[model samples]
Target chain A: EAGVTQSPTHLIKTRGQQATLRCSPISGHTSVYWYQQALGLGLQFLLWYDEGEERNRGNFPPRFSGRQFPNYSSELNVNALELEDSALYLCASSLAAGQGKPLHFGNGTRLTVT
Target chain B: GESVGLHLPTLSVQEGDNSIINCAYSNSASDYFIWYKQESGKGPQFIIDIRSNMDKRQGQRVTVLLNKTVKHLSLQIAATQPGDSAVYFCADYLTGFQKLVFGTGTRLLVSP
Candidate 1:
């Protein structure tokens, strides 16, 4: 089966602009998650969507928002992007929000804010 | 604060040797732990995971040991190869938290 896939492998946007990243989970997966990986840092959880509803989110600002589509795909939107917003955005999927399930991640979208 | 963190920023080992990466978490409620391997310009891939109920779990050439007493976890890779060189991260998750908290990550360097 195909793994999680992300689009626009590389994205460059100026400050104050908005950036959108897309992700498709593996088949039969229902939970989609977003994470931001900054240089020299670990992955920071951004958002979580399960069953088409926003279930949980990290400490990121409201400018960092996303939604899960009916098909279980997810879109992460970063509005008013700042220079610090530049990072690799990763998408992952799991069988469900249940405990003990490992997440399968995609290659990620490299978002560069200039 | 709920956070997972690595003890080492980098580790260098020779090929065919064993590699060990360590991590710790602050949240005692975290019952599940996972280790991930990420290559350059790529997202993290699942390597191995061990629940709080297990002291050790093995997969392929990798072993994950979890110690709830110290809130510590370790990933041991046997016969390390150059291909095993990458940034390895440990993550923790609570049963109802619905999200996994990741550590700072440790870069593993293997020399042939």
Candidate 2:
């Protein structure tokens, strides 16, 4: 089976602009999660979507939002992007949410905010 | 503000040697813990995981030890190889939560 896949391996956007990143979960996976990995920093949880609903989110601002489609694919949208937003955005999928299942991650989309 | 943190920022070990990375978590309620290896420009790959009820778990060449008493977790790699050079992270998940709180991370360097 294919692992999680992310689109736009690299994306560049100007400050104050909006950026959108996409993810496709592995086959038969129902939960998708988004995380941000800043340079030399650890992964920071962004959002969690399960069964087409937003189940949880991290301490990030409302400008960082995303949605999961019925097929379990997800899209993360960053509005009013700031320079600090330049980082690798990762997408992960699990068989289910809150089940202690190990998440499978995609290579990630490297977003550069200029 | 409580989060998971590593005991060291970086660890250097020789090839064919054993390597151990340590992490401390502040959330006592966290019941599930995972260790991930992330190479340059790549997402984290799951190395292994252990639950609160378990003290130690072993994989092919990796071992995870969880000490809930002192809230410490560790990952040990046997006969480390060059490919093992990467940043390793420890993450904790609460029983009913969907989010994972990651540790600062430890960079492992293997030298021949």
How do the residues B1-112 of candidate 2 rate in per-residue lDDT, one tens digit apiece? Answer: 2323343388999999999999999889999999999999899999999989899999999999999999999999999999999988899986566678888888899999
**Docking category of candidate 2:** medium
Worst 10 residues of 2 chain B by lDDT: B1-10
Candidate 1 steric clashes? 0
What would the C-alpha RMSD of candidate 1 be, to one decimal place?
2.1
TM-score of each: 0.96, 0.95
Candidate 2 has what TM-score? 0.95
Error of 2 at B24 (Å): 0.6
**Individual DockQ of the candidates?**
0.57, 0.53
Per-residue accuracy of model 2 over A1-114 as CA lDDT, tens digit each:
889999999999999999999999999999999999877778888999999999999899999999999888999999999999999999999988874788889999999999
* CA shift of B107, model 2, Å: 0.3
Report the number of the highest-DockQ candidate: 1
